[model samples]
Target: MKIGKIPPDVLERLVFNRRGAPRREVLVGPAIGEDAAIIDLGGYYLAIHTDPISGSIKLLGYLAVYVPTNDIAVRGIPPMWLSIALLFPPETDETLLDEVTKQIDLAAREVNVAIVGGHTEVTSAVGRPVAIATAIGVGRRYISTSGAKPGDVVFMTKSAGQETASILATDFENEALKKGINKEVLDRAKELAKAVSVLREALALADLATSMHDPTEGGIANGLAEIAYASGVSIEVDPSKVIVYREVEELCSAFGIDPLETLSSGVLLATLPPDSVQEAEERLKKLGIPYSQIGRVTPVATSL
Candidate 1:
């Protein structure tokens, strides 16, 4: 078992195959690469995403909200509500709980989402605090990860490993410092964590994108592979064109972690029809979000 996500084979063989029952309302249930589940809501589609914060403690509350919310946003929807659960170690105190709640409150307020309901408790089963969130959003029209068409252009927002770099610097500061990662570099990586949410950018390109996915757990390479797998299309990504920050490279090199397979919560991977590429680029530019054309969708499924 890995610290990140369950491997695809295990999910397919054990979980996906044993889903309890079939429902007419579930337009999208469990599937590889599809982050949020969509359900028919009469006039609109309800997109739901549930994710947990496990690896880093630096911004646990904040990450809890954004990580799951990112999935809903990529489905062409803005997360308007959330239900959260916070689990704390037995030795944790009230002050720490209050601070975490404060953090969650602040982030929820910033995104205009209400913390509708949730539970909090201290348990001896866990060593540290972990936050889990289930975000709900509604969209009139939504895009799917499996909608990528052949000849569609693949695109990415921001650099890969933004979350991984930030977490490494904050959680393993001593190790990073010993490895000659400068104070300024570490600070920059920490700062990058605040910009993890892709709600605004996702909304901007929602209409133009044929498919969208947030690269978490498995990073950019896996994210691209998912797009290909879900859509049944082959992706040819130019490794050189995929942006990997120097700081990320240095940090990952020092830690012996694969940045491409690490947790990357902020980056968005999208595919667009050739005719809509110009509009997508323009919208991203207008939003001041840096983007790059990594590759194109091919007719045949191939290696990432």
Candidate 2:
């Protein structure tokens, strides 16, 4: 199973309902892919989002950080604190737990966010390890999944399916060490896996943006479909400009899987004005982040 689906009962028990302190400055809350629930305190607003990593345990810590934090960053929120919850099977080892914690800390460090309080537990309810993180941030402008507008350029960071590529590479290396795929290729794949976080670019784009979407599940194509359908705008993507990493291409070919259709955790998408596109390209360059002009937003019935 993919290990994701908000069950109606669980949703009603945990996510759909909440008891909170009195509110006034709340800006964004309880919205999909919103990352963080934003509460504006006048001078600065707080952005918070929660996420759990289950099936992709190999990169649990990585997704635990970016997937949730990116929510706030896309809305122009800079992460301030992260609260984590880790649940694992009864047989979960201490060493594995330590490694997961280390990865989480490293992810936070990479984005200059702090890991605050959290909970950890081992139970029979699960057969493997799973982690959830609630990321909080500060911002002035608020952006959500429904933030796109007609005529905004839809730009994405990294090629699609970087994470899936890494997985295939790892799986392949274990299976093909006896085959002919070279160590250099395998090493590069690991690097690509670790390079999935997009906090910097997301925050930068939020400074002046229409909307942002991270291509996670279903790659860029599926993500574009979600944005267009959600915001009621049409999108057109140029396959040539979409940047899929060289190693990911090779890996996908090896697995007989379509990289464009796989799940990519590290990809970031932004919709901005056409005029600022060039400057944005330079900014991505300076960050050492690869991107592409894959598509544009237009007024239409649905996403192309």
**Best-performing candidate as measured by TM-score:** 1
Model 1: what TM-score? 0.96
CA-lDDT, candidates in order: 0.88, 0.75
Best of the candidates, lDDT? 1
lDDT of 2: 0.75
lDDT of 1 by residue, 224-244 (tens): 889888988889989889878
Instruction: Give the TM-score comparing model 2 with the true structure, all chains together.
Output: 0.85
Collision count for each candidate, in order: 0, 4
**Backbone clashes in model 2:** 4
- Expressed as tens digits, the lDDT of each residue in 190-272 for candidate 2 is 78867777778987777667878766766777778767765778888888888887777877777776888777777887888
